[model samples]
Target: MTTIVHNWSMIASGLLTTLVISVTAYAGALVLGSLLAVCRVSPLPPLRLLAATWVTVATNVPVLCSMILLGLGIPRLGVHITLLWAAVVAVVFSGSGYVCEAVRSGINTVSKGQVEAARALGMPFGLIVRAVVLPQALAQAIQPLVNILIACLIGSSLAAAIGVPELTNVTRALNNQSGEAVLMFLLSGLVYLAIAYLATRVGSLLERRLTRSQGAAR
Candidate 1:
């Protein structure tokens, strides 16, 4: 208790850092993942193959391994990547794969008849996707996307291994200094639980609003 009180500022800073990284990484993942999802469903065989390969490799590789490669290996090759950006890139890379899968699944759920009708009307592929497919798919993808956001938040803690000083890293340092490992970890866990709960609630609210809007549109 005393330890946490004394280190409140540090803990708050670390929490803020964690949020920044998670949100940034999740945003990047959404953009990259959406592109990947499009490619995965592209008419071009090569594009589909490339996107599939990326999803396979990125999903299979551990986030820590990616981090180490970006943070340590790249620097040895004479290219500079700060630990912060390395962490962000690594999370974005891995998270993008999951996001791609979620979006692809949502895309799959879109009615094939609608697509066929759009094609029959001579709509270009891009216009059909943008005007007829993506909006509906994205609505269905909300929960999965939210889950990815939460995963990004948890995964941000791994950045501590590369010395990013996120919440878990700060907690670890405090534990080492105060020797109150139980209390320190417990406090951090509670914070995480709270944040995750809020994320879930927000997802639910958004899902309900979309559902109501869709129902009314029908």
Candidate 2:
């Protein structure tokens, strides 16, 4: 309909915002998640307990509840977060737990002898983690991490519930005002598909690069 044509730009803008939220959240999750995973595997009981608490708390809380708390509660604390930031933080918190577990599982797949070999060569813990352990573990974890990224893409939609004006929100607005429900939803679906396709492609590329390096070393 003419209304759909007239408001196409708004829909596009919303989709772009959604994309940014997902990508930023994915990056933040990776860093925080790596730290959590390390703590979970640490020998110190206190550290492991703290890490497990993070996993349990994050997994138990729904994204909607977390977003409402962050988006609403932060302003009262004089640390006002824009909807964009609130949604980003919530998604990171939601996905980071899963990412941490995946990384731990990947690390488990790595043989202990690799660390022993690194230590036998007088390699420091930092170098062993950076040059030996992390590389292999990341390679093994690529698939599950990609799955987390996909979850992020879907979770980004939750921002709309918090009035973040993400893709679905814009679609709803456009459809309600213009009665072009089918067109707006179709466009929104395509945007999601594009994001999913890109995530999958990047995962495949990383897998290939890691595999090639692994083969070269062997």
Candidate 3:
């Protein structure tokens, strides 16, 4: 308790770093994932194949492995990469695969009849996707995407291995210094739990609002 109080600033800094990394990575993942979802559903076979390969490789690779490869390997190749950005990119790369699949599942849930009707009405593919498909698909995808966001938050801890000094990293350092591993880890866990719970509540609220809106539109 004394140690935590004394190191409050460090904890706060670490928490901020964790939030920044998670939010940045999740944002990147959302954009990339949405594109991948579109590519998976594209008429172009090559695009579909490429997206499929990306999803397969990204999803199968461990987050730590990706981080090590990007954080260390890229630097060795004569390219400058900050540890922060490396962690963000690694998390984004891994998280995007799950986000893509979640969105693709949402896309699948959209009614084929509606798509056919749009086509019959002479709507271009892009227009149909934008005006009709995506809105509905995104509504269904909110929960899954929220789940991925929480996953990203937890996965941010792995950045510690690459010396990113996120929450877990700072907590470990504090433990090493103060010899209060249990208290340090417990506090860190509580912080994570609190953030995750808040995210879940927000996601639920958004899901309900979207559901009500969709119901009323029907």
Per-residue alpha-carbon lDDT of model 1 for 16-119, expressed as tens digits?
99999999999999999988999999999999999999999989999999989999899999999998889899999999999999999999999999999999
Candidate 2's displacement at residue 59, Å, is 1.6
Error of 1 at 80 (Å): 0.6
lDDT of 3 by residue, 25-70 (tens): 9999999998899899999999999999999998999999988988
Pull out the clashing pairs in model 3: none
What is the per-residue lDDT of model 2 for residues 136-176, given as tens digits with 9 covering 90 to 100? 77789998999999999999998998899989999898888
**Candidate 3: residue 51 Cα off by (Å):** 0.7
Candidate 1 regions with alpha-carbon error over 4 angstroms: none
Off by over 4 Å in 2: none
Worst 10 residues of 3 by lDDT: 129-138
At residue 213, what lDDT does model 3 achieve? Answer: 88
Q: What are the per-model C-alpha RMSD values against the true structure?
A: 1.0, 1.6, 1.0
* Candidate closer to the true structure by lDDT (higher is better), 1 or 2: 1
